[model samples]
Target chain A: MLAELMLSALLLLVTYWFIVTRRLSSAVSAYSVQSWLLGLVALALYVDTRLIGLLLFGLLIVSVKGILIPRLLRNRVAFALVAGRETSYYVRFPTALLIGAGLSLVGLLAATRLAFQPQLLPQSVLGISLAVFLLGLFTTIARRDAILQVTGLLAAENGLLLLSLVVAPGLSLLIEVAIVLDVLIAVLVMGFLVARMRDAVAGTDTSELTRLRG
Target chain B: MIDPALLLVMLATPLLGGISSALVRSDRVRYALVVPTCLVTLALALTLIARILATGPVSAFANWLYLDDLDAVVLLVVVVVSTLAGAYSIAYFRSDAQGHVLRPGELRKYFGLFHLFTFTMVLATVSGNLILLWTGVTATTFAAAPLVDFYGSHEPLEAAWKFLVLAVAGELIALLGFLLLYEAGIASLGSAYNFSIPVMEQAGPHLTASLGAIAFLMVLVGFGAKAGLAPMHTWLPDAHSQAPAPVCAMLSGAELNCAMLAIVRVLSLVTPANKARAGGLHEALLAFGLLSMAVGVVFLISQRNFKRLLAYSSVEQMGLIAAGFGIGAPVAAVGALLQMITHSLAKSLMFFNSGNLLLRFRTTTISEVRGAIRVAPASAILVIAGALAIAGAPPFGLFISEFTIIRGALLNHAWAVGAGIAALLMVAFLALMEPFNRMVFGQGRGEPLPARAELGLGVLAPGYILLAAVLVLGVWIPGPLHSMLVGASQVVDR
Candidate 1:
């Protein structure tokens, strides 16, 4: 239980780093750490429950999300990394951090109000997961760079992975595998789009993608 | 008693087509493979529908794949629209190739993605496992995003990017909801809990109320975004308008309905546990429905681009269907089912006409394409008819379905809801017709019609066939179709 809560806190911290970090490379690395923490949480649950599916899912999360996806993103958007540091955001850093804190509080309150079963993990994990999820969503909305947006999405999905581990670790292996595969493809496609955006719009900044608006 | 292997064939035909299309360099060979593949899939879909109506639901692969009346209804729409769109793509792309608007490689990519898109939708519709259904819905984003960016220009890429971000984010939220639902199921079913539809339904009545409510709300918002429900419908118009016309037709006419089917599936599961929860869910559905209708109508009135206007109209039509289901009256539910079919046929026809206009005028701006009747008389008349039909005019299928929905609302003594629907439908009707009337009859912007502007029989046949189907549905709901709608609605109304 102590381990789970600490891991959850570390996960939330990494998500915060992802939101406020200036360097695009730092943000990508923060997301990888966040995903690794999620896999750790899943592994912690497996230790408690002795469920083999949870064990496999934890490894899957660690390898695919932690290792494979981040590497893919770094390679795909190396140009953005070379450009160095996310300079523009729809929401500035201090304000974004404050908002993330507030969202975390809201998640805490929601966790208190809702009746999560919390099968084997600590209950606070639910609130932390929700906070991570919301912050990831905010990151996507707040960031201007296309690669940053993709990182935000990855962070958000990690939040979901954390929640699923706590609430329903018994979910079928087939489904877990399928969900991971879908995210993999989504990343591939988003990477492709980011590459295309760089070519067509001449920058990775999504705000420049303004020609299609009503 | 139909062979379940037929289901496997139905799913594989498109995958095979997609793979072959990608491998073949020649556009003619790709088209030859694609059209027949679509037709065979349609025939298989029809056969399954008949057997389902006759023999009840079909299940295969250890019941991981299943199709009942409700699935059949959605499958029917998907197959019909995709088949038509698939057949029409040859002409649409041929014209684009002639104009040098698309390269040979791009055409091959288009057919490949088009079939893959169809495959994902079919997979979602036939999936009995809730998780598999969710996976299929998410896969569609990946499949269709490239198609949206087929032009690979600024606008198309922007649209595709937005579409991808919004859709992927929404599906993640939905994943949370589905997981919560599974948690709720575990409370009663324990280790027997599977994410299959039947298992979930079995677990429904015993689900924890609070968890179930949260799950349904999340699912509503998440899937609602995909279905073009308002507040989350920001991506719909941009993506739909920017995609190729045939792709737009499938996206609007078929894909949105499939997402709605996912919502209905969850609703069916969530509503059975408690009355208060069911009522709250219905109210929520109605609120989103009304808001979408209003948003769709407001945007429809001010729209400059014809394709975006149609896209907003989709938002409105989907809202009406959502509202109909929200009413929870048997008649309303049935009307919503019929509305799904009518809207699919009519909207696809309108898009096909829009494709025609785009081909001739080289612009989707309503102001630029005046005097269309003088250019392509057949397409112009069909456009006017399609506009009227989609706007719920009399003697059109949408009118009957919309009326049935209103009548169902009134029958339930939801007078305010009934009147609200009526007023919105009226405003939408005028908003749709005025622009279409101008486009079809308004003077050409003093420019001579382009030579070879008239459509070939191949391009126009799908439009006429869709028009005929829409008209026939308005006048008469065929016996088998009526039964299918009733059965499908009963699944929702329960």
Candidate 2:
């Protein structure tokens, strides 16, 4: 239980870091690490609970999210204007990171309020999950570039995966497959659009794509 | 046999028709087939509606589809709108430069994509799982993307891309929500969850309450994008106003409802204890719905484009439906379902008639077209009827449904009901009065409404039929439908 709770907090921290930092490659690498930890958590449950379903789900997460998704984005997504210097963030990185920490603490405080049987997993997993969800929302709102926005979108997915891991846990590998398939499709479409954006507007900035503004 | 053939046909006919029309290269044949194929679809929808009503929830391919009372009602509305949209499209395309003059190949692909979109929407309604439902949504976005850019112009293409980005981004958020749901409550097997409503519900108690709440919020925002709920409804007006009229009908009439259904199903699975703690998802929906309705009304009052005004009205209607679900009572739930039915029927009818007026006037700016009564009298009457029904005038089912929602709100809480009623009146007035003043009496700088291709009686019939059904539904509730509504409503709880 302690192990799962720790795992959830660690992943949440990593996601917040990925969203707040300035270096594009480093942020992507942090995200890859986060996905790896999520897969590890999935696998750990597979071994601890002897649940065969988690193995396939874990493997898919590790391979597709950790390896394939990052690789596609990295290779297909050109440097994307070398990051940094976007106008207007809801919160600065350090502040968002601090806010994320505050959310995690609040999450823990709420978990105690739930007063569950105090399994390490159930007690703190709730806090980590909620904080992660908020951080993802924060990232989506803050980011300007399309690829980064999509990455924020992925972080949002991670938040959800963390929440689901704590809630209704025994769905199947099929849901995992579905998630990966959607991610892959999204990556492809965004990749295509990224190139199109570059071609049409001569820059891959998402703000430039705002052609239909009121 | 659950009649897999019928399902396949539903999927096939539109794609085939789209292709042949593109290939034939003659506007005459495009005119010939669009109406006939849609009529066949209407026939199929009617039979499907009757069969579902008679047979009670058709399940097939091992629970992939559980077409029951709710879906049957939706399916009936689809038949009404899509058929008329099709007939209207026939006359509609004659004025479309590309549809009339395009090389066979370009025409085929455009029409093919349109049918594919219809098939995807139908599949979304019939689907029983969350993932497939999401897939259907993504499919619609992709299919509509090219159609929006069909004019091959820079601005439309840009609009299409923007539409894709926001909608896909929103949908991905929804996908994440569903995934979290998949992760909820570890059974002994200790894995992520399936997309089944039942599986999630069965695991409800075992799951962490906060996780469920978080999942609900994410899915709400996600589906809200498609449903045209505000703060996330940015893509809707731009897309609807720019897309072809039939496409606009599909976008408003069917796709938004499909996304809303996904949210409704997810909310139903929220554990009772969690719902109590979080105020369920209703409060959240109510807040968003009211914001959307108010925003829609404000925009509707200010709009000058005929099509844009209608699009804003859709946003307002969707908000009302969302708020209905948020009210979270048996009466409110059924009211929400009935609204879904009536909105689809009326919006499609409205869009189809709008298509006719467009053919007559060759422009969509409200300032450019007027005295619809003088030009295309038959279509004008249908469009006006559609507008009246949508505006919550009596005899339309929407009026009954909307009134039921307000009354349900009042019964639940007088203050909330009053607030809701005010919003409805404001929006309803904006949509009906603002547009009619100009459309019925105002004149624009352009060629007046022209008499074009033969306006088929079939084209006129579907909109009126839908309005007629709306009228019948307002004053009456048949016993069987009442039972189904009662049953579905019982599932929603605080």
Candidate 3:
């Protein structure tokens, strides 16, 4: 249990890095590391439950999310940054970090207030899961580059899965597979779009997309 | 007894057809394949509805696949719109190819994704489990994203990107809500019960009110985003306006219903738990509804692009339907469902009309094109009729549904809301008419369209059929359909 908490703390740290980082590639790397930790956490859960489904889920997470997706995102960032270093945050770094910290606190408070079944899971898991979730959302909103936003989105999904695993460990295999595959396809589509945006408009920054607005 | 195997066939036909469309080499062969596949799928859906009416409801695969009155209503709308749009795509793309707007090779990609989009929506409508339903919605974003970016240009790509990001973010929240509800379920009913709709409904009263309310609100916000409710509806206009017209029609017409159906399923599960808390849910929905309508009308007044204008109008129509659902009266629920059907029909026809104009005039700006009636008389008339029908003019189905919604609001002692909706509808009508009149009757600014400009029957047939259905539904609903509406309303009614 202490090991699990330690890994979660490391995961939170990586999420904070997502907020402070300005380079799109760094943010992407932070996201990949965060996903690796998430896979580790899933492996820990599998060790406890001895469920082969969780074991396979952990392996898939590490491979698909931690390895495959980051490689895809890196290719996007590599060609994308050749033009110039891009500013990814609308809010200033300090202010965005402060806001992200507050969001994390709110998550903790809200999680504690919920009447979760006590015998089934530890309370801290719920609070930490929510904090991770909120931080990811903050990252998405704060980032201007579309790739970082996709990274932020993946982090948020990781947080949700953390909460779900603790609260409902018995979720059917079908749902787990569906959730993973859904995220995978979403990332693939976003990667394709970002690549296309770079090739067509010369940048992956969403601010460039102001041609049609009411 | 109905054969349960038929449901599998309904689901498989689209999947196989979509795959085959992608693999086929010849565009002509692909187009031919698309129409027949759509027809078969439509037949299967109609048969499913008939069997559901006959057998009450059908559950298969341990309740993983289910069909009830609510599913049938939504299924009927999807099949009708998809069938029309699939048939219409042939002529629509042919014009684009001829005009050099799109290459002939791109038609294969468009047709393939079109069928895939239809299949995802169909899966969402029929799936019995909430998770599977969520899966269906997620798949829709993936399938439709490419379709939206069919042009592979800057504008369409940007629009498709926003559509993907916003939709994924919103749906993830809904997933969190589902997790929370699952936690609540385990707390109440133990772990044996799964996340199937029937199972959740059975265990509804045992769910804690506080948790259920939160879950419902999450659903309203999340699914509401996909439904193009305001604030989260940022993706709607960009994606709708930039997509090829037939794709836009599917996105605006059938896709929004699938999202709303998700919200309805969640509401039903929560309502049985606590009556007053459920009212809170309704109040939240009502607030979003009004806000969406207000925001939509404001944009409608100033929108320059005709396609985006239609997108904002869709926001208004969806907002009205959301208000109907929020009122939670059986009458309002019926109106909401009816408006969904009518909006799908009228909105698709209007979009197809816009497509015709775009092909002829080569522009989407209302101010740029003038004296449309003199160029293509048939298209001009169709656009005018569609404009009138969508504006809730009498003798159209939207008019009836809007009236039903107002009466339901009044029945709920929401006179102010009723008045507000009525005023907004008038403002929307004026906004729409101002632009539509300019395009149809205003003096030409450039050379008149070629005297030979004419519409093929294949192109007009689907839209004509839709307008006729909307007109007929205004004055009359067949017995089976009426019963279906009542049954669906009961599912959501208190």
Candidate 4:
């Protein structure tokens, strides 16, 4: 349990770094690392319980979400009409870092108050998951670029996965599959949309579709 | 003695038809295909409805698939609306630029996706488990998104993307709410994790008060979105206005009904203990319902685009349903169900009529779509009647249903009922009157359309039948359906 806590804490740190900083590659790498550790935990759970479903699910995550998706996105970024560099956010880097630290601290304090088997994950994991969810939503609203918003969307889904780990044990194999499928489909559809948007107009700022302004 | 296997077949048929539509290469043949398929599905759905009403919520197809009095009522609406819209799409698409612009494969994609969307909605309503129901909605949205972008134009694409993002995000929040609901269910049913609505309703009072309240609010947000109620209804206008007319009808008429049915499904499960402490849940629904009505009306009053106006009417109608359900009285709930039926017909008629308008004018701008009485008198009359019916003017089914809702609202919760009905009436009245006035009275300046621009055969027939059905339901609901409605309403809550 303590080992799982350590791993979760590590993930929280990386997720924070990914969302707080404005670098595109950093956010992508952070999520991929998060996925890597998630596979580890799944593997551990599989070994402990001998639930073959866990092994299959873990492999599914490793191959599809971690490897295949990231590769597809990197290729799209290099070849597709992506704008230069990463987009900036509504808040500054220094302040966002402070805020992230505060969120982690608050999550830890909240974790201490909760009563769950400490072997699963620390309550602070929920806080970090929630905080990551918030930051993802924050990025979607704050960033001007559609690509950034799409990244925020993926980040939010990451937070959902984190929450699922803490709350549900192994009862929901299909549920997890359904959620991930939706995210994959959403990203693919959004990719097509980004291409179309750039073709129609020169950029991908969605706010410009305000043709029906008050 | 009707077999539930037929119900499963009925649900799956339109989907099969949709798939068949995509495989064919001819636009003309593709256009003709969905009609027979819709009629067959309707016949099967009616059979299912009849059997359920006769036997009382027959176990259809499999153990997980059950249709109670509530499901019977909702299923009827879904079948009726989809059939009509399928017919309308034939005419609606061919007259527009898409008929010429669409590659043969794209036509199949649209029709295939259309049936896929219908399949998910049916799966959602018929499923006995809450998880399956939720997943069904999610699947439906994915299936429907491509339909929203079927025009393959930039605006439609963007709208479809935005709609998917907003809806899926709201659904995730709803799932969080569902998790809370599961927690409460655990507290009540003692860790069995039963997902059936009937099982949960019996187990509800044992659940924690705070947990139930949280779940209630979460449902309101989640289903409230698909219901197209305020604060979460950002996608309706853009998607509806941008989608093809028949697609608009499906979205406005059937899709929203399915969402509202979901909320009521959960409501049926919430224990009286929850309702007693959470007195304000109904009030919150009322608030959102009224907000939806007022917002839809305000937008409708100012709108120039015909399809967008219809989209707003959906908001108004959904609000009325919410108001009816919010009152939570058996009488009020029945009224809400009636509202669902009437609104489906009236709204579809409005869209079909608008389909004709777009057919003639080649533009959806209300300001430019005038003198329809001269343009195509038959379609013009249908548009005017549709407008009047949706506005709840007398003789139309919506008028009867709205009257019932307001009357029931006055009886059960007088003050809220009176004020909500008045506000709704005012907005809906103005809403239907304004754009329709332009459609019927204003000078239409566009050139006469070619014969190809006229209403197509595959499209015009289903919409007319739907209009007839709406008229039939308005004047008189058959005994079996009415009996089911009463049974379902009584089971709502005391």
Candidate 5:
């Protein structure tokens, strides 16, 4: 339980790093490390439960979320690396971090309040998972860079993955695999759209994507 | 007894069509491949519906894929709209290619993606497993994203990006909801329980109330976003307006229904647990429904773009359907199901008309285009008719369905809800007709009319067919369709 709590704290730290980091590359790397930790948590659960499904799911997470998606995202935004951290945020860093912390607290409180079966997993894991989920959503809204928003979504997705691992690892293997595949496809599609945005709008900032509003 | 093999055939037709269309370089061959594929899929879907109606629900592949009365209703809407959109795309894209708005290569991609989009909707409809259903719904976004950005222009790319981001975020929430639901089921049914719809339904009584409530709300907000219910409906207008006309027709007419179907399926499981829980779910649906109606109406009154006008109208109509189901009376549920069909017909017809307008006037702004009748007489008349029909005027299908829904609300003794529906309908009717009346009839603002552009049979046929269906359904629903609607409603009423 202590080990799981530590991992959860580390995961939360990585997500915070992702939010504060201005460089797109660093944000992506933080996401990668966060995904790896998620995979590690899954593996630890597998060790305790001896569920082969969890074992495969852990590997799948590490390989897909940790490795493949970040690489793809990096390639898509490689040009933005040299462009020197575009300076436009709907919310500034400090306020965003404070909001993130508040969201984490809410997640923690909600997890405790809910009548989650205690024997399924550590309560802290569930709380941290929800926190990461909300932070990811916050990251998407607060950042203007399209790539940052995508990472935010991925972060949220990782949070979901963690929650599912703890709450319903008994979910069918086919479904777990299919969900991963769906996320991969969504990332691929988002990456493609970001590329198109670059070519059409001449940059990847979502602020310029204001043409379609009411 | 329906043959399970038939289901496989129905699904495979589109999968094969999508692959072959992508592989075939020739435009003629691709059109031939896609159009027939849609027709074949539609025929098979109808056959399956008939069989299900006759013999009850059918499950295959160990209940991983199944169709009941509920699935049939959604499947019917999906197949009809997608088939029409498929046929209409030929004319739509041919014009685009000729106008040099799209190159030949892009046309191939459109057909490929179009069929793939259809496949995903079908998959979602027929998925017996909850997880597979979620996967299929999420896949629809990925499939349609490229098509939404087919123009490769600034506005479309923007719309596609927003569509992707918002939809993914919403579906992620829904994913969490499904996880919670699964956990709820495990709490009751043990870890060995299946995630199939029937299993979930059976386990509903055993579900923990708090967990079930949270799960239902998550699914509601998540799928509600996809279904174009406000305030999550921000993506609907942008994506629908920016997409090509046929794609708009499909998005408004079909894809939204598939999303709604997911919500309904989850509601079926969650609400069966107990009365208080059911009532709470109903209240949530009613609130979202009414809010969406108001949002759609307000936006409709101030809209500059005709396509956006139609998109907002969709938001209104979806709201009506949601509210109808929320009424939780048998009559209202039936009305809601009927509204789904009628709305699809009317909305697709209006979009087709908008496509015609876009083709001729080369703009979707309501203020810019005048003297539409002189520009293209057939399309102009159809546009007015479509506007009237969608606005719930008498002698149109929507009016009947909307009336039935109000009657259902009154039967439930929900007078305020009934009055709200009535008032919104009245304002929406006026809001809808005002711009369309101006655009279709008035003399131009000193701009030369395009000389009587000839709309091909391909484009006009779908609109006429849809308009005819909407009109006929207003007056008389065929016996089989009436029965199908009742069967579908009973699934919810249970």
Candidate 6:
């Protein structure tokens, strides 16, 4: 349990780094690392609980989210880097980092009020998971690059998956598998759109996708 | 009674058909597959409803696939809209191909995705499990995102991207709510955690009120966005306008109804447990519903693009339906169900007619295309008729449903809310009618088409059939249909 909480705090730290990073590649790397931490947490729980389902679920997470998604994002990033495009943000890096920290702090406070019993999971671990989720959402809102936005979404899913590991362990494996499939599909589709947007607009900047506003 | 095996067939047939359709290179063979596939789907859906009404809901495969009266209502909408859209796609695509609006290659992709989209909606409607329902709903975004980008134009791509991002985000939040609810069930029922709706229904009264409130509210916002409710409807106008006419028709008319059903199902499941939670859910839904109508109407009055105009009208009608469901009275729920059916038929017809106008005028801007009466008289007449039917005119289905909703609201002593909805409907009606009139009846700025065939009867046939159904339903509903709607309404009433 102590190890789980420590890993969750580490995950939240990586999420904060995601917001503070200037390079799109680093943001994707932070997300990849965060997903790996989640898979590790799942592996830890599986070892403790001796549940084959958790073992399989952890392996699934590591391969699909932790490894494959990041590789896809990295491929896209390599292309963008060769093109010499930077990961631009609506908010500056410093301010965005400050706001992200503030969000984590807020999430820590909000986690105290959650209705879960303490025996299920420590409130602080839950709070860290929630903080990770909020940071992911902030990453999406603050970034202009479509690839980073996809990474942010994956980060958010990672947060939720982490939370479910501790709080809703009774959730059926089938549902978990289905949810993972959706995230994979969402990333694949977003990646395709990012490629298409680059081709059409000659850039990956999403702010220019303003052709259809009222 | 319809066997559960039949339900599985209904679900599997389209998915298989979609895969096979995508492999076909010949447009003729693909379209030949389209009508039969839709007919089989419709036949299965109708049989399912009949069996449900006869035997009082069916569930099989460990309660993974279930059809109640509520599912029956949405299934009807899916069957009708998909069948008509499928039939219309033949003429629509032929004309569009001829006009160079679409290549034969694109048509193959469209038919492929069309069936897949229909399959997703059917899956969403019949699924008894909350997770399965969410899967179906989210899969729709996956299927339709490419369809929204079918034209491959910059505008369509922009719309598709926005639609995908917003939809996936909203749906993910909904997943959180489902997880929360699952945790709540585990806390309460331990070792008996089930995502099945029937299981949840049985456990509803045992659910903690606080958790149920939080979970349902999250579900509301998340599913509400997908349903194109107000304040979260940024993606609706762009995607609806940019997608092809038949795709737009399905998206606006059928998909929205399916999303609404998902929300309503969650509300019904969670609300029966606690009154305070139910009241809160009702108020939230009412607020979202009212806001959607007002925003939709405000946008409708100002839309220059006819397709966007139709899209906003969908928003307004959806708001009305959502508001009726929010009223929570049995009668009002009935009104909401009736409105769902009427809106599906009428809106799809209007979209089909708009497609014909686009084929003739080669434009979507209402101001740019004038004298539709001269350009394509049959489509123009049908457009006008559809506009009136959509605007809640008398002798049309919407008029009856809207009136019934108002009466239900008043009967429930929600006088202020009822009156407000009525006023907004009136404004929306005028907003929709005025633009349609200018386009169809106003002076022609462009020269009429050269001596050529009007829109083929095949293209116009779907619209005519839909309008006729609306007109007949306006005057009177058949006994089985009326009872089905009433039964469906009762399913939602706490």
lDDT, candidates in the order shown: 0.87, 0.69, 0.84, 0.71, 0.88, 0.84
Binned by DockQ into CAPRI classes (incorrect, acceptable, medium, high), candidate 2 is acceptable
Off by over 4 Å in 2: A1-52, A66-133, A162-169, A210-214, B1-64, B78-80, B83-91, B97-109, B130-195, B198-218, B271-283, B410-419, B443-487, B490-494
When summed lDDT is taken over every stretch of 10 residues in candidate 3 chain A, the lowest stretch is A80-89
Tens digits of per-residue lDDT for model 4 on B353-441?
A: 77677667778887766677775666766777778788887777887788777877778757766676777687669767877877786
- lDDT pick, better of 3 and 5: 5
Please compute DockQ, using alpha carbons, for every candidate against the native two-chain complex. 0.74, 0.24, 0.68, 0.31, 0.77, 0.59
DockQ of 4: 0.31
Task: Write model 3 residue lDDT over B347-377, tens digit each, in one string.
Answer: 9999888888888888888878788888888
Interface RMSD of 5: 1.2
What docking tier does model 1 reach? medium
**For candidate 1, lDDT tens digit of each residue in A46-70?**
7977889989999999999999998
Q: Could you arrange the candidates by DockQ from highest to lowest?
A: 5, 1, 3, 6, 4, 2
Going through the candidates in order, what is the number of backbone clashes in each? 0, 20, 0, 2, 0, 0
Q: How far in Å is the alpha carbon of B50 misplaced in model 1?
A: 1.3
Candidate 5, B183: how far from true, in Å?
Answer: 1.3
| Residue-wise C-alpha lDDT for candidate 2, range B1-494, written one tens digit per residue | 74556665765676677677667766566667776777776676656656665666565655555565565556655656666666656555655532336554555655666666666677676766667767766667766777776655445656776677678768867876665565444432154334554445556666666656776887899888988999888878887777778888888898788788778777776646375574546888888888888888878876777777888888888988888888766677778888887788778777776766666667777777677777667767777777887787777788888877777777677466547656766556656766765675555566645543445675566566766777788788787667656655655542
Please tell me what DockQ candidate 6 reaches.
Answer: 0.59
Question: Where does model 3 sit among the CAPRI classes?
Answer: medium
Docking class of 6: medium
Chain A alone, TM-score for each of the models?
0.96, 0.84, 0.92, 0.80, 0.95, 0.92
